[model samples]
Target: MSALEAARRRQSWSKVTPEAPTREQLLPLVAAAGRVADHSSLQPWRLIELRGEDRIRLGEAISRVRGDDEPSTKPLRASLLIAVVASYRPSEKVPRWEQEAVASGVAHLLSLLLDEAGWGVIWRTGDYTRSPEVAALHGLGEDEALLGWLYVGGKPDRSPGSRRTVDPEPLLTALPR
Candidate 1:
C-alpha cells in the first residue's frame, strides 16, 4: 500500500485477538521504523517485548500502584506489548525534546507498519506510567522515561473503519511576510 493509504488505514484498535506477531516477525518492521529522522542520528529510544507472564507481571505492578487488591486486566488486553522508552542522551547538537520527538516518531511509524502487516495495535498509557513499581518492572534507567506500551494482537474479523479527518485550516498557517 502507498504511504498515504497506510497512514489512513492506521487507527488504534482498542480490542484485539490473543495472537500477535513474534519478536522475529517484528524485527524488520522495527528496523524500518527506526529510520525516522533523528537530529544527530542519536537513536535515543528502545523497545521491550512483553508477552505472556511479562504482561501479568506488569499488570501486577500496575495494580499495586493503583492500590487495587486485584491485578489490572489492562496489560492483558493484548497478547503482546512493546514498551516504548525514551532514553535521553546528552548532546550539544540535539536537544532532549527533539530526541523525545524522534522516539515518538518511531512509535507512530511502527504502528503504521504493524497495521500494514495485518496486526491490530494501540498505544496505551496511564497515570501509573511513571510510578516506582512500573519503572522498576521495566528496569528503566534514570535517563529513560516510559513513553507507553503498544498493545498488539490479531485484528478482529471486522475491518477497521477509517479515522476522522482533522481540519487543518486553524492548525496550519504560513509565516507572515
Candidate 2:
C-alpha cells in the first residue's frame, strides 16, 4: 500500500503488546517527523522517550496527581511512551499558537509513520497530561508545555477494523469575493 493509504488505514489500538520499535528503528522516523513546516525555522518542539521503569515512575506520578495511592497502569499499556513537548520560542514573526500547530503536525506525521511501520499507536491527552507535576517529571522547561503522550507498541491479534471515510466539503471554505 502507498504511504497515504497506509496512513488512512491507521487506527488507534488501545490494547497492544509490549513489543515496540527500538530506538535505532525510530531515529529515522523521528528525523522525517522533524522535517515539518517550521516557520522561521524555530524548531519549537522536542520529544522525551520513556520506557521500562520510567513508565512505572510516570504511572506513579500520574496516580499521585490524582491523589491515589495506587499507581495507574495506563502508561504500562504501551512498551514505549513518547512525550511530545511544545517548546515555544518567543518570536515576533511567528506566533506561539502557530509554533504549537507545527509541533502538533509533527506529532501527526510521526503517528502516521509508526502506523505505516506496522506499530500500534495512540495519542493520549488529558488533564493529567497538562499537570505541572507531570511536566516537571518529564523535565520540561518552564517555557515548554506537554502536548500529549504517544503510546506505541505491537499490534494486537485482532484487526483494527475498516477506515471510516469523511467528506471534507463541509469543512472547506474559500474566500468570498
Candidate 3:
C-alpha cells in the first residue's frame, strides 16, 4: 500500500488476541521507528521490550502502585509491552524539549508500524511516568523520562471502535506568516 494510504488506515486497536511480536521482529520495528526526526541527531530514546516473565513482573509493579484499582487481568492481557524512554542528555546545541519531540516521534512511528503489522497497540502512561522506582526498573537516568508503555498483541475479534469524523480544515491549516 502507499505511505499515505497506510497512515490513513491506521486505527486504535484496544482488544488484542493472544499473538505477540517476537524479540527478533521488534528489532526491525524499533529500528524503523528510530529514524524519526531528531533535531540534533541526538537520538534520545530507548525501548525496553518486556516479554515472557518480564511482562508479569511489570504488571506486579503496576499492581503494587495501583492498590485496589489494579486490573487483575493486566498481566494476562499485556503479554508484551514496549516501554519507550525519553533520554535527554544535557545538550548545549539543542533544547531539551526538542529532544523530547524526537522521543515522541519514535513512539508514534513504532505504534503505526505495529498497527500496520496487524497488531494492537496502546500507549499508556500515568503516575508511573514520574515514578523513580519505575525509572530504576527501566534503567533510566536522571535526565530521562518514561514516555509510555506500548502494549501490543494480535487484534481481537471485538476491539475498540474506530474514531469518528472530525473536520480536517480546522485541525490542519497553514498560517501565513
The most accurate candidate by TM-score is: 1
Candidate 3 versus the native: TM-score? 0.88
Evaluated against the true structure, the overall lDDT of model 1 is 0.93
Candidate 3 lDDT at 70 equals: 63
**Which run of 10 residues does model 1 get worst, by summed lDDT?**
158-167
**Sorted on lDDT, highest at the top, how do the candidates line up?**
1, 2, 3
lDDT by residue (130-157, candidate 1, tens digit) is 8888999999999988989999999999
Error of 1 at 5 (Å): 1.0
Question: CA lDDT of 74 in candidate 3?
Answer: 63
lDDT of 2 by residue, 29-78 (tens): 99999998999999999989999999999998899899998999899989
Candidate 2 residue runs with Cα over 4 Å from true position: none
lDDT per residue as tens, model 3, 48-72: 8877787666666666666745633
| All models, RMSD in angstroms | 1.2, 1.3, 2.2
- By lDDT, the best candidate is 1
TM-scores of the models, in the given order?
0.96, 0.94, 0.88
Q: Tell me the deviation in Å of residue 21 in model 1.
A: 0.4
> Which lDDT value does model 3 have at 110?
94
C-alpha lDDT of residue 49 in model 1: 96
